[model samples]
Target: MDNVQKSMNLMGLAQRSGNLISGEAIVLNAVRSRQAKIVILASDASENTKKQFLNKCEHYSIPVRVDFDRNEISNAIGKIRTVAAITDGGFARSLQKLQ
Candidate 1:
């Protein structure tokens, strides 16, 4: 499969395994607490939202991927969110590998 499809499949796995978290506030909290190993933000997000997430992830030393759109992400994780984070390092690394 293509990298994007693989990444989305992995996200589904992460969600099923309880290693992924979603929503803006919850994801920001996870980043602040260092629980978020990697963050995935929708590429189509508003510039303000994008800036906020990018800045926070940078400050926290967490990796961020801004490739997929909100629908793609929500479909992968089965949640209607524009932002999500992988809490498990293994899952995070797996996602990073797709980049």
Candidate 2:
């Protein structure tokens, strides 16, 4: 699969394994808690949200991807939110190239 398709599939796998956390705050919290393996932010996310998330990710050395738009990301993860974090092991490597 392509990058976008792989991301969507990985998101589905995360959801099935209950390793997905949606929304900025929850995802940020997961990152702060050192539970997040990778963070995915919508391309259309608000500037402040994006900036803050990026800053935190940088501070914590977490990998992040900004490939999909809000609708696409939300659709892929089955949420309306603009951000989501995967907390499962090995998931980060799957998204590394996108970071």
Candidate 3:
């Protein structure tokens, strides 16, 4: 599989391993509290969402990735979500390496 596919698969693993947080509110909280190692924003997300997350991530000095669409992210995590946070540093590092 390609790196994108591998990344998606790793997201699923992260979720299963309880190292990921999904949904807007939870992710926002995680980011603000510095609990999120990295945030992934769906490419198809709304402008407001992109702006908000980009601003928050920028202010907090957290890494963000917008490589996947909503469908890809939702499919990987088995949930309909536009945003997600990898809370574990190890998982975040692995995903970054894949990117």
| Per-model lDDT | 0.97, 0.84, 0.97
Please write out the lDDT profile of model 3 over residues 56-84, one tens digit for every residue: 99999999999999999999999999999
What is the full ranking by lDDT, best candidate first? 3, 1, 2
Error of 3 at 41 (Å): 0.2
* Residue pairs clashing, model 3: none
Better of 1 and 3 by lDDT: 3
Query: Which residue ranges in model 3 land beyond 4 Å of their true spot?
Result: none
User: Residue by residue across 1-99, what tens digits does model 2's lDDT show?
Assistant: 677787788887777789888987799999898899888898899899999999999999888888888988777778798999989867767667544
Residue range 5-64, candidate 1, lDDT tens digits: 999999999999999999999999999999999999999998999999999999999999
What's each prediction's clash count? 0, 0, 0
Q: Candidate 1 at residue 24, lDDT? A: 95
TM-score of 2: 0.90
Evaluated with lDDT, which candidate comes out highest? 3
Off by over 4 Å in 1: none
Task: Give candidate 2 regions above 4 Å deviation.
Answer: 97-99
lDDT of 1: 0.97
Top-TM-score structure, candidate number: 3
